[model samples]
Target: MTATLPRVDTAPAAAVKRRRRSLGWVAVVPLLAFTAVAFGLPAWAVLDGAFTDKGTGAYTTANLTASLQGAYLTALVGSVKLSAVSAALATLLGLPLAQAVVTSRHRALREAVLTASGVLANFGGVPLAFAFVATLGNAGVLTRHLDLTDKGWDLYSFWGLVVVYLYFLIPLMVLTITPALEGLRVQWREAAQNNGATTAQYWLHVALPVLLPTLLGGFVLLFGSAFAAYATAAAIVGSSVPLITLQIADALSGNVLVGQENVALALSLDMVLVAGLVMAVYLPLQRRSARWLA
Candidate 1:
């Protein structure tokens, strides 16, 4: 009770906040710089080159118009169809696999499945193409043994590309949807059962609604992955399949046509636009999923 206490200082709190803010900026600096150097610069270049004449340095829409005509249009359609089919198949196959992994009793089995999925999801490009070729191509070991050619199997065709795509796509979906599957609460199922709801009814009325957003998001991701794929298709089938990515490469290298570098940029821009539209749909679904899962 005795004396005048020294005035408590409040400046320390402000100083701490300032230090934290500085640290936050410091942490983000590298990321910002990397983005500017890598993604931002390249994206800007593509946008610029797409809208400008290379020789005349004049603004034009000719390149974009050219991208939408003839074989380029066919390539776009083929790419979209391929991506859609692969994403759909991967979603259909992966949902069951993810459910099984989530519901498994053994921890080791769950861990192993998840580990394999993580590795396989990233295991694309040349090596993956080569593996498929060795296993299923015309002169492949399995091909010779199984006589798949006579049975109407071709590893260098559109369906064959679909088959190859599913190898990585399914694992990606598994990795993506497993968390959503795990987010399913036991209490929900228990409550449904207690209320005399059949398993089918529970899934149809309750679980599907909860999982729908995440499922769509996963599908969109898989579609984008398939749409942008290049190396694997290039290695496996060359230019046999007229995919948009292959067309873009062709335009860039002046292989199919000269003086079409701007058209290549235009195609790249189209890809970006498509990807943007996909993300626009996916973002809302992702947020909705988080509302339930979180």
Candidate 2:
């Protein structure tokens, strides 16, 4: 302070920050553009069509009314039921499988499991349906050998669909929950035991609380996966099983009734809303899970 210190300038630093921020936005422009073109436009078309009559280019709510009634309503309910059952089963079965893989002593076995899970998770749609059919369909090899029909097991039935769904669903859950399972700290278990907690008690109290959010998140994802499924169900059970996606396809393809394209859009809108609701619930849980797991 003895001499007049050289005047400090904050202007240049502020300017540099502004420039960097602008550049950051510029870098993200392409991604934003892509999303707008790819997703936003299609979503807008569905939403717009849902409120507009197909024959008359006029706005109306008739499509939604028609979609929420009769067979459409049944399909919606069936889709929800299927998704809930499959997601729940997958979560129940996959949690232990994921835990096993994560806790395995052999690194090779872990790698193999994770690799197989990745393959299986993406191995759904038509091919997966065919694989299940070959293994369990009416004229399937297993069906011929075991005579499952006599036991009242039908591969084209609801329970059969659930079983086929689990083939991919379990693997998806395994892939998703494995990282969360790995996040579980050994020290926490040791500490719980030090405090006189038994193995079951530690897991029931500490481990479960930490893992609940992640498990719920996984369930939501699986539910959405099952809800949106079309090809696999189409290939295996066709229109026999009342599912939203199959109905939507029927509407869009004019297989149900002509001039119901707007109804298809309405169904799509309903699906979007349902999926949005699921994500709305999932986001908070996922954030909470991250706080502990991170």
lDDT of each: 0.95, 0.94
Looking at model 1, the pairs that clash are: none
For model 2, what is the C-alpha lDDT against the true structure? 0.94
User: 1-294 in candidate 2: lDDT tens per residue?
Assistant: 487879899999999999999999999999999999999999999999999987889999999999999999999999999999999999999999999999999999999999999999888899999998998999999998999989898999899999989999999999999989999999999999999999899989999999999999999999999998889999999988899999998998899688788999999999999999999989998999999988
Candidate 1 deviant stretches above 4 angstroms: 1-12
lDDT of 1 by residue, 176-266 (tens): 9999999999999999999999999999999999999999999999999999999999998888888999999999999977888999999
Best by TM-score: 2
Worst 10 residues of 1 by lDDT: 251-260
TM, every model: 0.94, 0.97
| Clash count per candidate | 0, 0
Least well predicted 10-residue stretch by lDDT in candidate 2 = 1-10
